[model samples]
Target: MSDKEQKSAYGLGRAARLNLSLEMLNEMANTGRPMDAVLSSYFRHLQDALERRDRRDLENRVRSVLLHYRRLLWWLKKIKLEPTMRAMLLADMILSENADIPQLEKLCNGARNRMDMLRKEEIAALKRLLGKEINHPDMSDAVQSECPDWAQAGLKKAFGETFTEELAALATKSTSDYRVNTLHTTPEEAQQSLASQGFKTEPCPMSPIGLRQSDAGGPILSETDAFRQGWIEVQDEGSQLVALFAGAKKGMQVVDFCAGAGGKTLAIAAQMQNSGHLVACDVHSKRLSRAKVRLKRAGIVNTQRVLLENTYDKWVKKSRGKFDRVLIDAPCSGTGTWRRNPDSKWSKDETDLSELVALQADIIKSANRLVKSGGRMIYATCSLLPEENEEQIENFLKENDKFTLVKAKTVWEENFETPYPCANEDYLRLSPHTNGCDGFFACVLEKK
Candidate 1:
């Protein structure tokens, strides 16, 4: 059979999947869009045409290439070749997918253009130099970790002795986690329902209501009855922990400040038991609208969506000192989510971090006004940087004497029956290496 006729283990033909993966990568570079968004739009029309297995294969191939994009480029550079998408994809096959080098050589030699074909000398070099290992002893720390130079220093400083371990965790594929919407069904019921539909899941260690797939890249849960029935929502365990830390109770007036797309808002509303008012506020009206749909699907009725012009909007002025709980899931560098969104690392820089830190500072100050005396304000970010996480909280505390830090460990003990895993003193800092969830930092401060 021709190479085009040879099917990959994931179900798509090798040649077809490779070419499509290259196209997707190029589109991501040209458009500056995320892989998921680009994939959705690229395959919108092909949804009906492609089988589920084929789609999964395509997604896996694209994700693998992106996950090791920097390393693949590094290998290509080491071989003294142009770092092209096609070249990187080949390197991914050899390094990540463990494809046979002889087969790759045969396939590339048959390509139409001379640029596409690997020369005999290049093939010999690939055989001599490349191995199953993506990282090399000679590689720079940044290249080995697949992060920018500036970020590598920050991550090293933040993680200290565990820097390599943290990088390994961040490099691995993200686990598929789902938070059981307690408003619709209990964790037991959700797990049972998913299991009945051929989806095997395990309870997340930290979150009581969280379930994760037994394996990576299971069929999309959106097609399952459990998701359709609102029994489960795709949420990281770390994020669910943040909502729990907020301590939203029945009949408590809460504000999900900066509630973009409202993932945490849904969790908070469920904890509120559909009683009292919950305001979901964001600068983007479209995100709030999307969250409205999720709220409805999750059977959350206690929440109302509010669009804000900025942190200092008229709504903030009107809602000052009114909420019992205010959650600011502020914008940041997204360093914590690098595993799930590897391309995001390259998209941002130190300048972006500085800007986000400033914005986060302004946001926390504005949102703090919504917290009534003795009420709690939860500041959260999916960033690993100190400037955006701990530093922001420290500055906020210095500026606002009325608000004092609440130990996350204390809240964890009060809320969860399970023992706290890590020893994060004042803040609830979670990393992929330590928490098996996305890197998240949440700090609770109460108004005196």
Candidate 2:
């Protein structure tokens, strides 16, 4: 078993878990792993540590600590703590789940330096001190929003100065929502089944196949028969919509060019009614293996999973100009996914984004070849930055003489029973404030 697996197998209390998380974060930050991926790794293990009945409580508390990390760091610094002291203070605060000031001071009373110093403060005044610090002009806007300095300018250029507030709100509450598996159950049936099993859910307004989930204090829906029987699969509504935009049809050839774990590929399978050839192709065979389980659970039989040697795979070259639809879920900075993985904002920068842009360009250039004449290819990323979204599509159109833009808004308006949520006419621009989902950009291009 992997080291991560071994860690999951061992038991740890809340404080110990927080310490492990901090150590892992420090190492991962050094190695340049995105906070979202790091947190996913950390939290999944924490889930394994708790009993099923107690899992939700531990999960909720840890999420709160992680979600407020920026504020916590700023708060620690404001109170005259050094860098080393800050990590210790943060761990104590996390163990207490950022409790009331008096309670927090009690938790820290045994600690040395700044934390011990804080225990001497008047109990009633600590919150006021916190407000004074976080409310200062230096701490407001992007700093207060927990977004990095370098990223704020681009975001302002995209959504104006007010985008900070929306971005900040998204940093909290990474709830578990699922997409209704239409191959097995209707949205209403799926919602009803979960409700019967003590889950609070409603049909997602934007995507017909989505279920916005709420907790009912029983086991998470993951442990329910409804899930095991393939009534639902955890998927963001933005993701469900991206699959919809691909427009797969029964008996048509489709390629999910970067089908990591087959999230979109399964959605596409339902669209195809399991009657056509659906290739779930990715560079990682491990992810494809995992995708196979989801495909089976989702009752998706028309799809075949393949490992790509690279963009220039022999299979891709041979299948050139054959697929009716090709979906490029390109790798990206994942700026749009900060709602669930707020730590990611700190890990990404222009240099990393530039590398991703080049890779995206390369993948699209090679993957587009699989689209037959007049077939649609959708270029997509879970990134709010234009450099990775609309700009990439614009540059691709310029470079590829035979491909033309397919206005996403028009397609959304005509194709769906409800109106599209975002205002961008030529490409998808889903965000937390507007769509109540993670940030995503998708644009369709058709080969001539």
Candidate 3:
């Protein structure tokens, strides 16, 4: 092909990016890679291979494709066609209005038969799939809700049927929200700094230091001076609440067990005014390494980073009954984070749930031992399912009579300046529909 034709055929647009992201989704499904890791790895490789800056719109378009993955698969099932044609016609259907059909020719490196099938499969199947409604009701509960059947049942049983509609929006459509690190600057100062740089931002209603910006049109958030200078960190409001309810005080010894990436650990440190000892422990060394960067960026110093060699580490054993408070951010199905990780909706299953629940039980029991008598421990997860949230805490209280439940409502009334979308009266539960944040569950337990 001529040089001009080559550029025209191979240029990656919205549809092409969606096709590429579908590859990421496939890897996440097949390889069990976290959606965040898979997407970041693919985009990084794409940018390196093409020797071009990433188009901001590309990630958004790809996310939209993944968000509608259930509907896309439903159509593929209906078409009676091979599932192997995902990158060509299947991705285009989701991006139909803006799909670049001609680009598929070069995406395939000038393969003729595949292109013909993509167009000619136009036979009867395309017609059937084309007219499907925006919220197609032809699907069962699982597909319509874009979740696993067990998750759908659990959420519905706990929250009600109307809650299922909110499940439809697996991810937030607005620009990401951030929490201002008061340890560095005030919320207004952080807002002003970002606004001065042409980033449109608004205060999050619930969090005193929460700032939100629309990704529709804005520079990359991580690139902002506010982030680099430790004025802000990308955190959800629900998360801020979880940390707030942890009730860390100055001069107190605290342990943030299972502190992945240190989002809440930083919050706890800031709340403690960097006064006392705070140990951030996690089993994953890589995640703690990432947390080390965030800690430095946030100008945090009070916290000690501990890499737990295992669930029962020597460090944990020495630290047991030493801390005034402990926070267990246990692993779960991650259904609550669907607003940020839409692909997770498709990846998790019952087997994963069984394993995670068992892990959570073990970690919570082990972590609770670190809390001193009369001290508090926040048992938390991003799972919407009660099995991982209330049930775990309930069982813990049942098994260990020395520890008692602390009402989330009572604590919220004491600390929060704004009202929360309260899901459970006892535990702090936030959902996407009611709270406009990622789904989260938190219950504070006190050691007697």
Candidate 4:
């Protein structure tokens, strides 16, 4: 067939093609079905249709489609619709089950009404815009090949007009960022060291130790001598800032409670100059094992890992009021890392948040008893939600009279750069969009 004839046979515009791909991805995510089969089926239909597109554009298009699916899933989760309902809708659409159309329409209407009732005005407005586009007869027929009537309706209900643009942006590649391992080398020295391995580094805008990769196609961890020598650690710049706020020093005893995989624990050890006794404690044995391997690779000799399976044990009693510093890097919903781990945005829910808050409160209360008189304890989370960050700390302080807020500005200035405007209350907040780093919240308190 001629090129013009092939293009006509496909009957797909860029927007329509993107919509079809997203519809397929939405089906995969909702049903927990394998994506390869769906993608295969799509390509099979397009076998002679997609003429000689560049490999890069093809990859970018696929990534964009997947990101759009993720964004739609995130919206659905935020509004508290049942995951199964979403899955069923996707299945009905992909399988072309016309009988399921009424059910899909009913769900979409119900979701819209719920949004209106809940005062989600922005989403409601978006819905109205999407409704017009999806309901157009010509577009409706084009979309029907991939999306069931209900699936098309759900897309309008889920994303509105901003959906396509948002997903495309999310699909774009993010840079590989690393925080300098301050214990072994300075940022300048680390940069020089990494250069020997043909890995170029540039300073991150917000973090003193953070470096962004300039080149691609290198196995950074294995190829770099600095990485093997522990001169650099793979950590978000925002996380490094949280560890600096902890203010741990040589010759002081410190505890990192809930130190999962030891990202911040390694930072604390570096700040302590590998001299102070730093105990890395967690409930998970596997995470502790990973931390141990990392600590050894980093040549940190003063740190110890402990598994606190029983918070009420006598070992806990002996540790009470003994440490100079404590860091509760509490478990959280991880909403701030969407740029890096987009999958987490779909996996979490309101019930998960509630459960995490309860666990955080319990852990904090247990750790609080171990802080010595006049010693500092910092509570930190990679969460943007106020309920997990400020509210959790406020509630903890309210219930525990012995501790009071220390000036976060004073501590941060003493250890690191002041990133935000000075506030009366002693707390630090960093958002990915605002701070050019992962979202984080940290508040330091001293026991009276």
Candidate 5:
């Protein structure tokens, strides 16, 4: 082939390949496919193409493809178009190579800037979608400021930015952390176990059993016997605090309401020294089944799992005011987890948030009835929105006059020595950037 003809053919092929990637990314994003799934599929295709010798500069080509598509996704998210429509538009735009790249970049920047102005109504809607409130102040503010004109206008009209400005300063990243299940082993033992399997570990500054990964890209979970034996269950340090705040001791009766997969439930069981009754309840049987397997692996014998299917009322009545402590790890928007699930920010909308808020309110009220008089009912979420966290607590206090916010500082100081940027007041709020943990908020409410 002539040199000129070969060069022209290569250029055309490159353009076609780039267009294909953009189409796939748009489809996955709009269809609400999990980001992990999308990335996995993209990587697999890249590997196959490389094996077939269909592409040169394989790594660079893959990187460029991802960067181009990510930019496109960011633009689509900004325009406030429905996912299906957004995907269609993205497909069309990619086909038109004459697309204005500069214009798209501008729109992405504008959306980011307006996220902090997220309206009150928009905030409420977000709460309903996640079945919880937003807790990270900074994240909430960013949403308000960077939300597109459509969302911002709607939010302003419905709920003027009555959000706490203090929270905006408190938003941070979520950390990749795991707590050592002290029920079966100590931190030192867990560390030794992990190290033996070639997994490097470092102590988390904010949490006692928490450890951070020093290296990336290894089968840490599959290779370690400690994980297999349940000496350590992968959990956020912030989540560990939920059990710590419960103050579960030997012989105490504790109920882990909404104990999906028994992460915190197992933590509480360990805290009770396996000497007390800990009932872990969830509406979903599949999650409870998984929890059972985990419990077996941990050798935890003092805990039992209950399925409350189609009978939340009956279940509540059956065990009313029967536990020394009750934990309501309520459903939430998960705004604080944006670092890990950045796509959630785009997938979420006002309608979803509204539904979540109502659910959270109902769950809290129902769970509160299970706590014995003077017993604590701790509420927690991984979200950073105030509507899900602080506001929900505020509303709960107004409706139920018997519960009072416990001083979080007291419990935090007694258990750990790390100083948080946000004061330990009525609630314990941790951010990833500031506290080096997952964005989490916990409020210990004592029945007065």
Candidate 6:
């Protein structure tokens, strides 16, 4: 048996698990990697020393601490404790986990900490100090929402009356969503295949082929045979909806501009029934190259990958006015995906958002060249900021008199055969609060 299999045969104790969690927490603090990536890398070293249940609980505990990162830091500072990784973890346990002080102290005895070892008195004092202000009305909006100070104003502008509700939703745990590869299997068959392997999934409310894991328990899809056979790909429901909105019917030419890792490329190809000529283009050669395996695994043959030197690569000039549909999944601040990537909340700032807004505008101008007259251009972002979504579309329409905005609801109904949800008329806006998916904004523009 492999080390992982051997270790899985005899799981680690709670203390060992806690130590691993601390190690991951500290690595995240030190390395500035995203929580999921950090956890994935650390888990490999652990070699399944923890059981599935313990493994999930450990991930949840670590994620909870990071998701409530700002609040934990605020509480730590309030108690005059240095906001070290260990301190933040303890604060998370006390305030967020509501961990028993005595048991928490006992747990820490088994967990090893490289710095800032906590004494029993400190843990008790933290419980006392943090408990008193758990819901203190004086808490700042950023701390209370666990949102970054820079993002607060923009989110308020975007969400309006439901701002707090949206932030709470973003701070909550997100489940894995998968889009069934219609090329390989039907949603019904895929569900049956997954159920056979211990996955419990429910149909996604919006996308016909999308499935949502009922809970985090059961086997992760990546390890299942269904995934290896390309029956399912891990994609958010909102993302699947966006690809469907691209409306890439079979035999039509389509461009997935900015097709990072081919998430939407795969979705669009499947929608084409593997018969269309789809070009997956990205500025990063590595990201575009990685899509080869995913494409092959999905049994997709209609798509071709392109490595662009930049958005203005010579390929764009040659391909201008050729594509029937152009999909720009523009890179943005990713504020919409904060629920799945809590660390991003602190990592981005006003300057970064401004830069992304400018970049999106530039990319839209360049990629719009690829859409033929009467063909449509689909612009999308996993961003909550209006500057990146509505404003960019508005500006594009003003500059290019030949192009007019197409109501997203019209395209949504055409693709999904159902009335669009959420409020905006011109754009498809989805949020964790309103759509139970990641926050997404998509609008269609067609040339006259």
Evaluate residue 293 in candidate 4 and report its C-alpha lDDT on the 0 to 100 scale.
93
Each prediction's TM-score versus the true structure: 0.92, 0.85, 0.89, 0.66, 0.69, 0.93
Using TM-score as the measure, which candidate wins? 6
**For candidate 4, lDDT tens digit of each residue in 31-126?**
655544655665566566654342223334444333344333333344354444333233323222222433333333422111111124433423
C-alpha RMSD values across all candidates: 3.6, 4.5, 3.7, 12.6, 11.5, 2.9
Clash pairs (backbone) in predicted model 3: 171-339, 175-215
Reference-based lDDT, residue 78, model 3: 68
Candidate 1 local Cα displacement, residue 68, angstroms: 1.9
Q: After superposition, how far is residue 231 of candidate 2 from its true place, in Å?
A: 1.6
Residue 36 in candidate 1, Cα distance off native in Å: 1.6
Task: Evaluate candidate 6 by giving its C-alpha RMSD to the native, one decimal.
Answer: 2.9
Task: Name the weakest run of 10 consecutive residues (lDDT summed) in model 2.
Answer: 110-119
Alpha carbon lDDT at 214, candidate 4: 75
Instruction: Write the candidate numbers in order of decreasing TM-score.
Output: 6, 1, 3, 2, 5, 4
Evaluate all candidate structures by whole-model CA lDDT and list the values in order. Answer: 0.82, 0.74, 0.74, 0.65, 0.63, 0.83
**Model 2, range 1-448, lDDT digits (tens) per residue?**
3555445533534444434444555655577776546656655655555566344443444455555566656655665444442343453353344345655555345322213335333343345343242334656676567677656766777788558666765775654668878888899888888888788887777898889876557666778878999888889988899999898888999999999999999899998888989999999989999999999888889999989989789898899899999999999888788777665666667788789999998999899999999899999999888888888888988888999998888778756888877776888888888878888888889889
lDDT value for model 3: 0.74
lDDT of 5 by residue, 69-91 (tens): 33333433443433343243332
Q: Give one digit per residue, the lDDT tens place, for model 1 in 1-448.
A: 2233332222434555556667788888888898888788756645544567667777888888877877888888777767777777777777876677777765555443212467666676566445558877888777777777657777887889888889878988898899999888899999988888788899999999899899644456887899999989999898898888788999999999989999999999998998899999999988998998999898988899998987799989888899999999999888898888888877777788778889998998788988899999999999888878888889888888999998988877878898876677688889999989999988889899
Those runs of model 2 whose alpha carbons end farther than 4 Å from true positions after fitting are 1-49, 52-62, 70-76, 84-135
List candidate 1 segments past 4 Å from native.
Answer: 1-12, 100-102, 105-132, 216-219
Off by over 4 Å in 3: 1-19, 48-54, 85-119, 122-124, 171-175
Which candidate ranks first by lDDT, i.e. highest?
6
TM-score: the better of candidates 2 and 5: 2
Which stretch of 10 consecutive residues in model 6 shows the poorest summed lDDT? 109-118
